[model samples]
Target: MVDYATARMNMVESQLRTNKVTDQRVLEAFETIPRERFVPDHLRSLAYVDEDLRLKDDRYLVEPMVQARLMDVADIRAEDVVLVVGAGSGYACAILATIAATVVGLESDPELAKLAESALQEQGVDNAVVIQGEMNKGYPKQGPYDVILLNGAVAEVPKALTDQLSPKGGRLATVVRSDSGPGKGTVFERWEKAVGRRTLFDANTPVLPGFHKQPGFVF
Candidate 1:
């Protein structure tokens, strides 16, 4: 059996700390959350590896370095309510729960959503909830979120998702990957009626389903 506790520590010290993930809360969350429980039985031993772990239906738990960076940049506070888009297996949600006031995990895959909920509950993560929904459409019922995290790369940040950001310093973070190029870590911030965007770093993450660019009509 893999020494999962040691593996988690190694991931934080090597994968996260070495890569500029300096937020103490974020580091502790990665260390404490049982990543092994979020993956399939056969793949649990590989949970703390420095790569995105594949979940059911082509979904993925975003790699730890990228995830920690996103969380650090978002500056999640104890009173913030966060929305996690494409929250496969709920790893991110569980992590966010420790830092934020509440976390809403939106997953498009029904089975994955169920799995995430079960895993979260088993871990006693009471500050988070997993809900099934369309990934492109931000869950409007929980509008005006303090922080929104896209669990994977997208060709573009849809306005619908951005619209949910609280117009008072709310921020949304994600990796934006265009066709035939590398992905960029991006954050969108809202203030009153204005939204600003900035790129943080480069990543080569897998694009989530429903986020691909639409094909134009061929001549």
Candidate 2:
């Protein structure tokens, strides 16, 4: 049997620490959560590896290090309400549940939403509510959330999602494309009623389908 506990420890020490995920709470959440359970049965053994795990369709579960870094940038708090766009299989939701007071996981794919609901229930994570909806719209009824996490890379940050953030509250961390290249991850924070966005790191992952930029006619 693969030792999940040992693997979790190694993941923290080797993958997260080396990549600058220095938050203690973030590290603890990553250490305790069983990432293997979130992946497909055939790919369970590869869970702890430092690579993005592809799902049934084009969606992907971001790598552990990437997630940890995103979580660190968000600075999740116990009293915070979180909105997770593109919940995937609920791995990121599960992790956020450990640190945030409440979480609303929105997944556009019905199949993935069902899977995520089942997985979260199996893990006894009651703090998170899973819903099937449009990723760009976000879960507005649950706003104003303290944090919003985008599960996959997007070319642009949707206005609807950012509108749900609490006033002078938290941040939104996501992998956004840059004009310079294909896959670039950017972190955006909302403070003092103004939004500040910046590129944090480079990540090559499949972009979420609906978030792609619309084409325009060439002159």
Candidate 3:
């Protein structure tokens, strides 16, 4: 059996801390959340590895380094309401719940959504809820979130999701993949009348489903 606690500590010290993930809260959340429970039984041992854990279909629980960096960039506050797209089995939601006041995890896969909800509830993550929905559309019922996190990479940030930002300085963090270059871990913050973007680091997370760029018609 894998010593999950030791694995979490090793991941925190080796993967996250060494990579500049300095936020104490973010680090503690990663260490506290039972990452193995969020993955399939066969993948449980690999949960603390420094790579994305594929859940089902194209879904993944992003690597610890990437998720930590993004959470640090998001700078989630205790009073903030967060929305996590492609929430998969709810690892990200559980992490966010540690910092944010409320969390909404949107997942398109019914099975994954159920798994997320069940796992979160089992873990007593009462402030977070998992809901089934189109990943790209986002859950508008709890609109204008203080923070938005995409659980995987995307060719481009969807307008639908951006439109859900709090507008009062809400921030969205994700890995933006490029065809010509490496994917960039980026943060987009809503500014007065506009949204500004900044790249924090290079990331290569697998693109979440429905986020690929649509092909254009040939002339």
Candidate 4:
């Protein structure tokens, strides 16, 4: 049988550390989380692979390096409340739960939300709460989060999501499309009265459905 623990450690060292994922806390969370448990039973064997794993329908699991990079960018804290948008299968949420005080995992797909809830519960992750809702609409009831992490790529960061930040208390990290070429990893942090958004790294990821631009109306 393949040693999953060893694979996880190797992934952290080879894929994450080499790619600039230097946050020790984030690396530790990645190494400890049982990634296979968050994936479908049939695809568990490919859990530690360097490629994105396709789940049911058009949704997909983000690559390990991509996820690790985003978490490092967020720089989660023990006292922070995090909101995980597009929380697929609770893998990212599980990672956030390890560092943050609380995690709100919002998913639009009912089945996926249920799967995430079950996965987190099975892992005894008590700091996360799973909720089903429209992917484009940010979860406001649990608002004032210390950090917001979008699990999928999008053309732009929604204002609704940004408005949920706790004053200058948090930041939002996501995969946003660049004006040219492929998408770029971006981070938005509240600064005084303004929100400063910047692209961190070039990335290629499947765009989340709800964040797509609407088609122009015919004349």
lDDT by candidate, in order shown:
0.93, 0.87, 0.93, 0.89
Any runs in candidate 1 off by more than 4 Å, and if so which? none
Residues 1-219, model 2: lDDT tens digits: 889899999999999999988889999999998999898898888899998899887999899988888889888889999999999999999999999999999999999999899999999999998999899998889888899999888888888888888768568988886556657667777775678887778787567769887787999
Residue 59, model 3: lDDT of 80
lDDT of 4 at 100: 92
lDDT of 1 by residue, 1-219 (tens): 789899999999999999988889999999999999998998998898888888866788788999999999999999999999998998999999999999999999999999999999999999999989998998989878999999999999899998999999999999999888789999999998899999999999999999988899999
Q: Which one wins on TM-score?
A: 3
Candidate number that wins on TM-score, 1 or 4 = 1
Q: Candidate 2 vs candidate 3: which has greater TM-score? A: 3
lDDT of 4 by residue, 24-97 (tens): 99999998999999999999888999878998787989999888898898878899999999998999999999
Clashing pairs in 4: none
Question: How big is the positional error of residue 164 in model 3, measured in Å on the Cα after superposition?
Answer: 0.6
lDDT of 3 by residue, 15-35 (tens): 999998988999999989999
**Against the true structure, candidate 2 has what lDDT?**
0.87
List TM-score per model, in order.
Answer: 0.98, 0.95, 0.98, 0.96
Q: Candidate 1: what lDDT?
A: 0.93
Among all windows of ten consecutive residues in candidate 1, which has the lowest summed lDDT?
52-61
Error of 3 at 88 (Å): 0.3
User: Candidate 4 vs. truth: CA RMSD?
Assistant: 1.4
- Clashes (candidate 1): 0
